[model samples]
Target: MLTKKKVIISIAVLVVLMTGVMLLGNQEGAAEAENKQVTIEAVNNKVYVMVQQVNFIEKAAEIEFKASLEASEEGIVSSKVGGKVVQILFEEGEYIHQGEPLVKLEEKEAGNNLRAAESQLSAAQASLTSAEVNLESEQGNFERLKVLFDHNGIAKVELEKAEIAVKVAKANVEALKANVLTAQVNVESLTDSLAYTTISAPISGMMDEKSVSLGQNVDSGTILGKVKNISPINAVIEVKQTNLEDIKVGQKAKVTIGEREPLVYEGTLKSINGSADPSSRVFKGKIQLDNPDQALKPGSFAKAEIVNDQKVEIATVPLAALAGNEDSCYVYVNDQGIARKRSVIIGETEENVVVIKSGVQKGESVICTNVTTLQDGDVIEVVAE
Candidate 1:
């Protein structure tokens, strides 16, 4: 049989053990409750963000655009008149001015024609002189007959015949004069045709194409070559129709070519095509860029932007700060060391920054990045950089 004192001692030790177990369970429960608390950010939290001032106005705003560079004036040159090309004055890729002669036509035939016309004119002049001499002789005869008739030494009928002869000779001289005038006019026409044998440039530019070679026979109005003008380059850009509302005249643009240093240019929205591209639903706009060096050429791809009408100068935050879609933008702003989820009104949105219209004020810290992993009213320890 066990002693009664030993049984009582065992019961006391069991009660002490149970009390210690209860104490440990209570402490563990308290620690778990503290661990459930979320860690978040406050205004004092340090994070690097790119920031820009914005303009909050009653009307519109300015939106930045990215695009490439292009030239406006580009074309091919062609010939106006044609003949056997005797000489090409300019080499391929030579700069030429307006009215500069490009090719010389073989003027052998034209020269022969001119010479023939000149010979005909000379012959006409000789004929005119002969006709004048004949008229003078006939007039002298008529005058002598008149004298004879006055003295009654000649018959009236004979004097009348002499006078008729004089009149006929004078008419012949006048007809010969007309023929000389006609011959002179023919000479001038031939001379002009001879001048047209040489082909010239219509505009000042660099010769791009030279299709005719020496001794090549070409007809009138045949295309001989091309000249390209590369100055005051124009950039053609297509913008989304929805984005057109933000674009207007006299906007500044920055253009970049592939691997080329970016160029800062100013442009006046020269034209806006009313019709949208049928497949792309994009509208077309043109920007004129000054390219005095003739570096920009045609058929180059480019992009452009029209600075928004309104100047912007308001509080702005990083794009990561904004919550929800574009329609309902919100952010978690830090106020007095507490993270508060707030609804925000947005204005213009740039690449990485957004214009805050309302719901957030200047100098307020907002949770900019990693918003999806955050909760409302989270307690966060501010980490310093």
Candidate 2:
């Protein structure tokens, strides 16, 4: 009976020892697995990313204004003389230079009148010359008669007749001289009028409008056509009365059509109105754009993005790096190997760039790639941009 009790006690003690050893082994295995998982997570958190340093940028705001484009210089071409449009020399949209002939008016009649005036001038001049010649001969004859009469070689009647002839010749010559001067003035007037029959371009430009055609009769001061310069186009815009102070001559602007990406242009503010518009209560402004190739057409709809002279220094980051909802916009910045979250206030977004209005410092590196996969404290690998 004592042997049986001893064996039972030993068996119970052995069972207790085996259970304790198994429990200790299980605890050690669980601890090792936890440590392995932690190591794996540390390795997986290190993700490759591209980063860019934050830079202080000059802040610019776009002030949109609707405008119409026009030629830098435009004018109406008109005829100076009343005549028939016998010949149309230029077509609409034709490029021309200053003093270039654009239209011809009744050249036949004008030429005839000019020639007639020239003939009259020649006849009057010839008459004047013949009278002068006769006067000289009569003066010589009168002098001879006076000398003969004084020497008692001729009668007083002969000397008096010669003197009368000379006086009549002198009077004829004076009348012819007056006629010559009158003819000369008439000739000049006709010549000037004849030249005016041919209309000429007043400025170097392209013909935008044509009102006269062949066989068309047009009176003086009649509209013939319109011409406009090609280079350096102008965009005339209207600004609100309250925003007039933000616009001024010499300010730079970006010009564009509505959603026409390929047609973007650079323009400069050229003029501002001296007074606000009374009816619309808006102010007039002008921006000039360079069109060296004459690609942009006048009278087109355009807009000007005028930037004010006022600028503020702000930090910038890549647009791709921004994350989170509108209520909580943030960026990931690399501090050593860990990503630090920064809440930001955004300003203007220009293409792939965004202005960080606040919550960013210059010279700080910002994680630009793998932004969505990054957490507030995740590790990052900065790669070349």
Over 156-191, each residue of candidate 1 has an lDDT whose tens digit, in order, gives 999999989999999999999999999999999889
Q: List the residue pairs that clash in candidate 2.
A: none
Query: Which predicted model would earn the best TM-score?
Result: 2
Query: Backbone collision count in every prediction?
Result: 11, 0
lDDT of 2 at 151: 99
Q: lDDT at 91 for candidate 2?
A: 82
User: Any runs in candidate 1 off by more than 4 Å, and if so which?
Assistant: 1-82, 91-93, 228-261, 267-289, 304-385
Please, what is the whole-model Cα lDDT of each candidate in the order they appear?
A: 0.71, 0.86
Q: Highest lDDT: give the candidate number.
A: 2
